[model samples]
Target: MATHLITGAGSGIGAAVARRLHDRGDELVLVARDAGRARELAERFPGAGTLVADLAEPDRVSWALGHQTVPDRIDSLLHVAGVVDLGRIGELTTKTWHHQLNVNLIAPAELTRLFLPQLRAAKGHVVFVNSGAGLTAHAEWGAYAASKHGLKALADSLRNEEHAAGVRVTSVYPGRTASPMQAKVHSQEGKEYDPARWIDPESVATAILTAIDLPRDAEINDLTVRPGR
Candidate 1:
């Protein structure tokens, strides 16, 4: 069974992907934000490993992981955990920008750096579950979009840097999906939230698994999953 380390396994697309992988008998190392959440995910997956590290506090990730036991062989590192607080450039505070950037970008970079040794050993894959906001900036998405845009740059640079080591990197950009995050976004926009109007989380999970399950001969560099509607 292939071993994978995944963040954001608690809900939304992360939960969907984790369930799919777990049902297939793959080994999972899930990253939870706290001891309580770790216990919750551990019970949910029933044999999956859990690591507790607050992605919102990127600066302390290294010290947090130093005290834990990371998987010795990580076949894939899934950067799925993210945070977003939407606001225009003129209205957004430094705290808002810092929170989004720390969780969505810096934390992933730090996790990837920490796990590179195992990833290189296994010639592994790193998947970044990015957003459509990563591609385009809108009126109220300045800070969040900036972080995601920076994430694209990070993934691109990592792909080039690790190609020689036989490691693969992929960035998945999904349009607004029917997730808790989507509900929050809709509330922020003062709009009605309709789950059916958006792409299913399961569909995004399928897209992710498809890319990672590809043969060693081919690598999917970027995948954009838009809503069919």
Candidate 2:
């Protein structure tokens, strides 16, 4: 089994992906900002490891990626950590915008760079869990959309640069998944979206596994997995 490193593994899509990979016998390094949650998840999975640090903090992110050794050779890097801020242009706060960009774009890019040697050594795959909002702009989702778009660009550029080295990149755009974040968004507006009708986190995680497990000759460059009506 391959060794995989997943960011944002304390919960949601990241946690689901970690569990799936662990169940398939792949070794995992799960990173998240929440230390307690990270420890809980690490405990749940046998042979899994955890790292806790705030991805938005440059020093913390660097320390987290630099100081910690991968449990094994990393064959896949899954970037699942992100932050979303919904507001009209004027409603956006400086902190909110910064947090959105730092967590959603910068941290993942930094982690990818830090792990480049390991990925190159293993000829691994890099997967970015972006959002449909990255491709299409929404009125109140300026910061969130912008950060995701930046992430998409980074993923594509990295794929092109690493293709000759047998390092592949795949960007998965999942729309409105049933997640706690989504619940928070919906609750804030007092509008209930059918959670069951949204895409399942486990399903998205499975798609990531498929992309990584495929032969080197094949690359699932970009994939959009949304809820089917």
Candidate 3:
């Protein structure tokens, strides 16, 4: 059974991916923001491991993981945790920018760095669950887009740097998916939230699984998922 260390496993696309992997009998190490969430995920995926590390505060991640039992070789490291708050450039605050950047960009980078040795040892893959914002920026998406754009750059750079080690890197850009985040986005936009109108998290999870499950002779560098409706 391959081992996977995944972030943002509590809900939405992350949860969907985690469920699929768990059902397939893969070993799972889930990262949670706190002890409470760690317990929650542990219960959700019985027998799966949990690590307590807050992605919101990127600086503390290294220290936090240092105190835990990290796996030596994981087949894949999934970066799926993210936070988004929308506001026009003029109204955006430094706090908002920092929070989004820390969670969406810096934390993933840090996690990747911490687990790279394991990834290299296993000839593993790194998957970044980015947003459509990573590809195109729109009004009121300045801060989130900037962070996701940086995430894209991070994945590109990592893929180049790790190719010789047989470590694969992929960035999955998913357009508005039906999740709490989408609901929050709709509320921020003063629009009615409708889950049926968006892409299902399970669909995106399937795409992620497909990328990771490809034969060793090939690699899928990037995937963009859109609403089918």
TM-scores for every candidate against the unseen true structure: 0.99, 0.94, 0.99
lDDT of 1 at 49: 98
Error of 1 at 27 (Å): 0.3
The TM-score obtained by model 2 is 0.94
Q: Please write out the lDDT profile of model 2 over residues 1-229, one tens digit for every residue.
A: 7788888776789879987878778888887677787778778887687777688884577766567655548889999988776889898899999999999998888888888999998999999999999899988889999999999999999999998888999999998888887887777567977789888898898888888878767899999998885
Q: After best superposition, candidate 2 residue 150: deviation in angstroms?
A: 0.3
Overall lDDT per candidate, in order of appearance: 0.95, 0.85, 0.96
**Residue-level lDDT tens digits of model 3 in 86-195:** 99999999999999999999999999999999999999999999999999999999999999999999999999999999999999999999998999999999999999
lDDT of 3 at 107: 98
Model 1: clashing residue pairs? none
Residues 121-176, model 1: lDDT tens digits: 99999999999999999999999999999999999999999999999999999999
Model 1 spans > 4 angstroms off = none
Once model 2 is optimally superposed onto the true structure by TM-score, how far is the C-alpha of residue 92 displaced, in angstroms? Answer: 0.3
Superposition-based RMSD of candidate 2 using all C-alpha atoms, in angstroms: 1.5
- lDDT of model 3 at position 86: 97
